[model samples]
Target: MEANDLRSYISSHKNIFVLRNKQFRDSKLVIDGCNLYHTLYFTSGLDQAQGGEYGDFETVVRNFFKNLKECRIKPYVVLDGGDGGEDGDDGEFRNLKKKGEITIRKAHALSTGRLRNVLPILVKTVFVQILRKLEVPFVQCVAKAQWETAALANEWNCPVLSNKADFYIYDMKGGLLPLWSFQWNILSLLNQSGEKFVRAKEYFVERLRPRRRRLLPVFATIASNDDIHLDKGSLPNWAKPSKGSTATKDIDALFKWLSKFKKQKQAINGVLSHITDPAYSDKVHNVLTQGLEDYQLYLSSIAEFFTSGTALPDSSPCLPEWTLQQLAKGKLDTVVMDVLAKQRTVLSFPVENSLYSSSNRTSQPIRQTIYALLLGVTDGAYVEEYDREELEITSSRVEAVLPSKVVPNLQLETLKDVKYGALGSVLSYWPLGTQHATSCHLVGLGYKRIPNNLKLSYSMVAKAKQQFFRPRQRLALKHVSHYSFSTMFRPCQKCFASDFWVLYC
Candidate 1:
């Protein structure tokens, strides 16, 4: 679901979000890793264009956690695996909804000179890097992290720090602390509790919500989300033309209509009764039912994973157990999940590129090399890339090749297999963060690099025909603060803190 729309609308309603100015006490906080990075990137006052200001971003994140440590707030971070869809009749619709979101983001980047927000693709990888560096306990879910985030928050009797509107629907013990209201940076210098507490808006779902709390999820089910993709144009206007036509009025119309029903079943029926064409009622019903189920509180699979060390089985044909553990531990990126699940990968635009051109053309070979590594064990493997071909999003089968034309004699097995050391020998320009399984460029070969620091002139892909842009500065990741960029790689995956800034970062 596009939760921001609902979140924004509800936030405007009176008595919803309450100020937690001095009430912000030391406690366990369940942090949504994806939301944390997404919100922090935009609020950090860094460049949305110019490829990326990752160095500045690192500092922003570091200071954020440093403040948390000062306040003694223990955080457990959880992040989404991908925009993956569960396989079923409506799976295509859901996948399209997710991809449509990407397309819209791309369009936003294209329309604006990137003055608007388009999260740098490498944000998650770098986020994981920072998390481990701070010794923060965290988990990267196999797919969605919202359920587990709420679960952990409930279990720990603590608040959730996220901007997801779904959190508003979940009736957790400690409620939600929205990202916009989480003023972690602003501290009272003269006050005694200066660094001892956070200032933010908290949502006490059971307290602040309307009398009909049960209908919260019901309202969410009818509101425009990924499942329904409902648009105002299709529905009758709840506001007048003179009153100013906006999505707010349409939402008001929904709430007004819902006010008539005493129970959710009646409301659901009422929603379906208005379907002008009977043909779509069944589909709408199914979607609404599924969305309602999303709000149902239960023991989270991720929580179970944390306790039992098991992994979610959403991947097709399933991934190797060791790979799953690495993902659970945040050692490996979800790129492995996408590769295993969809057999396709998405390519993002560089900030300096034209809307028409794909800036990642220079690094396609690296991606292909990665594709080869992940899929090499299987026969006649191919990976379709959701990339750009002049003003349109296009898919292409990336051709795989080994770096330096040297093949690493490693068996396609677990990440712990020492044969991967041979795998490290074949690749140049990078060493692992500390150990010897993966390297920086190597993980980026997994395609994290192409969308990241691999900046070439947007219009010069053919004319210049350059391989890659050199690092803005030359040094190791630990000494990065001395220069323009900073990185703290994961040791278990053996990727991070490499000597060369170009390949490692």
Candidate 2:
């Protein structure tokens, strides 16, 4: 996720504190549905396409999942489409599967980027349909677009796990910034030792650097309530399929629907035949011909091009059915507004206990603010305002108050522990603010300083007499400010003073 999205997700969620008295519940685990499916599909397809044979798709998926299980993580998986029920027997999509002629290979081929420009809609649809058959309960978020995903995450009070930084940008209330997301995994980064893992992950985290932005409000502004224009062909590749025995049956149904325009055009042609209006007749014939060509091209690609028995139409275009007005909120929720108010406040040393607590029924503004505070602490200092007017007050301007003299020693120890690694050592050898100490630091790695410059060059020319000629190196120049090298080597050669140059040693 981009830094912006991380900040948004963190700020829009409740803070998760290390429980002082009890262990956190396991129920908080939220798995990303789309992300997981994408992982399985892409990995399997790429692996297979590269000619590395794998077992069936189910086996590949199962093995992929087995790795996650070995890590002792049980993430709750959510999906955007209807569920396919258990044993692949029946669910919301069972009837459709029974009525459709879709095969895995044909589906995969039809879903290729040559058609959709590399989009994953077809893959998502396939998984959703399969999951529904397997009885996995997933939901299409009631709100359209990313907000639906964000809203679900908010309702569940869990991290919104997704590979896309865009998810973080959408202001999902109660969305936790997901760490250890699969996107970070790479072969070289994997290590046998725990220490190496820690170092590598720290390095990786440093690089992500989510952009600082108020992303939730921005996401809320763009989400659609209804459909828009099709960047792809009609009939989204992601739509659930109706099941039937023969692929031909599915294609026949699609062809019949497409042929409707043909019938209308023919009727218009028949009516125009009796009229003397040549211009109107010509216009009607042109529209019919164009529509026919488009429909035929779509069909020909599938029915004629591949030379296979599969029956599904190659593709179609679709548009969302809703209007903008339906998707837009009339007024921002008071709770969401309150969360933003807290972001403008001052940071507390020990995050308030109120920030850590979340009830399912309660609005998650407090939690979101706390999470945002935690994220801010990691990136920089947390500055908040209790009132709008106080926002401009800098930390220096705010008066510091002394703590109570009677505060418990244990509490002090706990606070110290929490902030321990937060302020990592400025240097291994010396602390900051020490005079001469900072100057002692070398420009590069610690080493003895050398005050000379050195240069080396080589000269060569082609020789036709000898089958092969060799090039030789010569010292070109030397000057130095300060630098060091562990070791240096050169071919042995004799040096003589100008007066003794006649005598070589």
Candidate 3:
């Protein structure tokens, strides 16, 4: 659950948090890669209402890394892509399991015209490309990155750069630079080395009063909507004490009450005893205990990657070892990692026409191509893709399309060794064209020029040749900024619809 309300209340509090303004420079920064990209994309002012302007996003990412180099900040980015598992192993990715539910919720929101910040599917892919292009150090975790990132930052004795309020729970000697207050765009006044700096607010748990420190995990569990939280019906109206809706007063009242307790168990019990009904007490106790346990750090497998450059989590057996290395090194797209390993993927809601059917339907053919690249190469396989149905997320298995003719001898392990000619041949091969798929829909973007009113079947474009993928890519990058993917199409009166017309008509 999100602890937005609580983090907001804390941010407003002066004594407990105390984000001191500082000039940050000359350090190895551990960045939350997922947080950085989300902040970058949202704040960049690039087109969000359209599918996405990834070329512009590419430039934005380039500039960011370029600026960091000028400032001498060696950035080590860790992205959240893996599942943080249960049994509380090394703060792994079991925490990320809820993402499926969240994806459905977001898809639901997008379907209902309630969401405006729909991210395009390839943003993370583009981020990886730029990082590799710039030779930036990064790791795509097989599990949740929190423990790995925290461990790296602590070992380096440098601050972690992020906007995740959960950093307040971790005790850091160097501190936490809240991404919200990080003025990275502006450089500092000329220093002795002529080095640049980011003026930002730094957070240290030590700044809090002695007794209140180290209790943030407990506080977050109580405040957030994340896993291990009690049912909302059982939520103690900490606000009840004030008999008012003001969260500030309630937070103060809650803190004052919590100050007397010494141990975490006592705090958990005291709150349970006071607010929750006795019937729900046992359930509440278990939930809070489990939630608090999330913050308990173990030996992070991710940290080993930084040291020996070897530690990476296990994926499905079908995935070649080479693919896992590429994924961990940020060389391959995570989409490939997802389909082969999990046999499932959650597609993003692109900014397209709302009146027509879901825009996700239009791009279904493209994703099936990726599935083919991963699964259909050697043997036929199925992958479940999550796309929108009305306002709800619905799942259906898509069969991978094989390039049997183009790369008859090609296999997953030998993908990196695929020659240029074979690559082009494979790229031109349409992997999955359904019986009803119109060439215009796959080769072009469901229309040649602009879709005045178009919505495509999510599975229509299941597999596309590179030639087939490019025009649609252009639509997302070049045309969607001006045209909606939801626009409808019509056949030409005189001309037969062919690949050329799909590209030009």
Which candidate wins on TM-score?
1
Judging by lDDT, tell me the better candidate of 2 and 3.
3
lDDT of 2 by residue, 236-343 (tens): 232332343233233223322323333444433433454455775565455444333322211111112113423222111110112111111111111111122222
TM-score of 2: 0.26
- Per-residue lDDT over 138-217 for candidate 1, one digit per residue giving the tens place of the 0 to 100 score: 88887677877897788778899988778888889888888887878964343664556777778776874463576777
Name model 3 segments beyond 4 Å from true: 83-115, 190-194, 226-256, 271-287, 298-300, 313-320, 335-342, 362-382, 399-476, 479-505
Q: What is the lDDT of candidate 2?
A: 0.27
Best by lDDT: 3
How should the candidates be ordered by TM-score, best one leading? Answer: 1, 3, 2
RMSD of 2: 30.9
For model 3, residues 1-505, the per-residue Cα lDDT tens digits are 3556567766777567888988887778999999998889889877554356777777788888777777788899999754332222322222233454465456456545675455655567567657877888889876567767876787678889987777888877678999999888778865687778889899888888777885666777666634334433343444334333455555556666667778788888776765546656676677678777766655556667767788486634555666667568865545555566667666554443334455545545434544565564645678877655654556898877644454565555554454433323333323343333333234234332212222232233333322344555545445332232322233342221111111111
How far in Å is the alpha carbon of 2 misplaced in model 1?
A: 5.0
Off by over 4 Å in 1: 16-22, 85-114, 188-195, 208-211, 226-245, 276-279, 304-316, 355-357, 376-379, 399-411, 414-447, 450-505
Consecutive 10-residue window with the lowest summed lDDT within model 3: 496-505
TM-score of each: 0.76, 0.26, 0.71
